[model samples]
Target: MNDVTQPVSRTVGILAGMGPAAGVDFVRLFVAACESWLREHGHPVLDQSYPEHWMAQLPVPDRTLALSDASAEQPLDAMARGLRQLASLGATAIAIPCNTAHAWHAALQERVPEVELLHIASETATDVERRGLARVALLATEGTYGAGLYGHAFDALGIQCLLPDQAARKRLMQGIYDGVKAGDLALAQQCFTEVGEQLRAQHGDIALVMACTEIPLALPQAPAARGWTLIDPTAILANALARRAYARA
Candidate 1:
């Protein structure tokens, strides 16, 4: 008689709703990443082969608003609650899709020490480094810029990050809040395109890192955006989470 072994199982958690749409988009990316993993590992694409996962689309406070205004209700508590909820539900590893929300990543990780909380900026920086890119432009919310989330990560990898000017940054924020968040793709496309063009003109044709999850929704559609190399941090983080879920024990 041959000995049989049980397949290892893991649960992936997504703490989202920073913006409802971005959260939904991350789910699609995760599924795609899982499919890629299946092909790479030579595993059959059976329903049972996928890892169990749960997403909590909690109505958390606005991360960008919280970060910019001290008086605004901080997202730490709400995010922590969400994290705890997922951990309690048997989530072995977790990923938060919002870039601005990652500002509270350390605190959230501390609250749920048992679960593996993937860092979006760290994973993105690793991907950028692996691509041998020396410089990149960042298009993100003012909160992410002020927090220096991607700045610190890229700096650690010795990758220079080109930032938009004050006006350009404001435009990018409007693109996120007024455009994508408001369900106006036309406005979002214009704002993202203007910023992308400005950054490209100022620094060369380097890769533009869509550090904000919302940016990817419209940036790809910009006409001028076609000439630039776009890096999707959300996708990078999703792939990282996928690898974690499928890692051999």
Candidate 2:
């Protein structure tokens, strides 16, 4: 799925900072993927290409904000406001790289009706359905579980999603919060690998979805992902944005 680009100025609105580090990985993916895209096409190393207007370093949600269900409205408001601001700066399209933040997607879309948003759930679900995988395992944060936004997409596609047990879910969520988001790469890696191991031990091939954008940063294509098919939402989101940009061209 590699091709050369004609080098156009593209602005991607990134609504990020669901623990900040995950946000960084999303931007890095776009740059590396696009740069690698150029190099693969036999183009001179593109130096002035990513004209993407990114409003990074936005005020991060505190523990109270992210942990509280009642605080959902505020963060969604902040995200919508951020997108509106970025759109004013000429962002042609928008993408939110955070999975948990997607729980409030309804609210955000309702408030900011003008910007075209690249949805991870719907687009990623399309890929999952194309693979003909009926039963899959989801590994994400508490918000994703509590909200079931990803689950809604899979359900609509008639896919069955299996989640980790409660204890495992707790450790995994903590891994996202105290580990990966905290920059503790080792712990994050351990948590994700352990979860993957558990899923594989079920004695059947299980499709694993890294429903959280922060996941692949810790649990990449390693031993844990060897037997199981790992679906990355962030990569899917990036490709969706690229295709949308292409269609507009």
lDDT of 2 by residue, 1-249 (tens): 223544654676777776577678777777666666657655566455444557454664642346455635356557877888877877777888888778767777777787787788888899899988888898987778887877899999999988888888888877677777788878887888888888778736787899887788888845656656789888888767655443434
How many clashes show up per model? 0, 0
Candidate 1 per-residue lDDT, tens place, 6-56, comes to: 235588899999898999999999989998888776776767777888999
Off by over 4 Å in 2: 1-10, 35-45, 48-51, 62-68, 71-73, 221-227
What's each prediction's TM-score?
A: 0.96, 0.85
How much does each candidate deviate from the true structure in C-alpha RMSD?
A: 2.1, 3.9
Instruction: Count residue pairs with overlapping backbones in model 1.
Output: 0
